[model samples]
Target: MPAKRKLKLVITLIGLLVLGGGWLIVSAQNHPSSQPAQQTQAKSKPKYRTLTLDELHHDPTLTYCSIIYYTVKHGKIQRWQEVSKVSLGWQIEQYPTNDGFKVLVWPDMNIKKEAKQLQPNWFALTKNDSVTYHSFIIHSFRDDMTATTNLKTIVDQINHDHAAMKVRQMTPKMLIVKHKNSAN
Candidate 1:
């Protein structure tokens, strides 16, 4: 009976040792300093920097920019999709409304047909308000509003008017747009 008890204790200790060792190895691998240089570089390769709206406009090299919307859930990106693509040359018209400015980005003729936002992609940015509100037309009552209502539908699911949106230039061609309100 004593021999059996000794054997059982040994087995339990061995199992615990194995588990502890495995945990250590995993933790070491996950540690930043222990990670390979190549892996670290890969993680930070496409370095994204915040660019002002004025900078985005002044950059003549920028042909066009795509509005990519992403939602983070459980500390992971759950939904990601390209919502709208507007040419850099597209005229940004601002109409003075009673409350704020109705900002409309008119599509350029040279814009690719595939990247066009067929429906009105107008957004409102409030002025002289205590809490600045940003709103955009993200839906249409009629199906005939646009050939592809998918973009609007997707945008509607993710964002609301209360959240503010900002533009960030990635590369000479790529643009990363960040909106405060997202479907988390």
Candidate 2:
């Protein structure tokens, strides 16, 4: 081969090698193996369990509150908002007798911390009434009567367990009660 042709061939081969090396470097950076240990672990472990209806109904120790009313348009039951415990109290007081589907929720305990972590907000509108809450569940009833009935049933059941239990309606839709025994 001519010397000029040989030089051209060498230069082309070098260019191809450089391009191939650059592509490999870029791909390695994007590979899952390239991710930090913490990120890989986080992706594998979920921060919270998805709330389910069965878990909510069966777990009485779980602190939760409900808003009883009938609404013309029903919203997604899974949705949640951030609010102070006090603010929730105020909302209950303000709309004691609204008519719509009943709304029940197990609010998140630390809204700020949960928000910072970028987790889904499932906290109820109320404050943390008990330390036992790990996650929250929210449900909406079809009508006011059904909600009221369920609320009464729940209150009665709680009272049955403790004779000294005093249940008070904070709002037409909200109830706040505590067992007389602190140990309970």
What TM-score does each of the candidates earn? 0.26, 0.25
Model 2, 51-124: lDDT tens per residue? 33343355332223322111111222323333224234422111111221112232332233333443222222
Which has the greatest lDDT? 1
Q: Backbone clashes in each candidate structure, one number apiece? A: 0, 10
Q: For each candidate in turn, give its C-alpha RMSD to the true structure in angstroms.
A: 16.0, 17.1
Highest-scoring model, TM-score: 1
Span of 10 residues, lowest total lDDT, candidate 2: 66-75
- lDDT of residue 36 for candidate 1: 85
Candidate models: Cα lDDT each? 0.38, 0.34
* Superposed Cα deviation of residue 150, candidate 2 (Å): 4.4
Tens-digit lDDT track of model 1 for 49-138: 433334424542221221222121111211111123323434343456666444444444234547554543434433432112122324
Candidate 2 lDDT for residue 117: 42
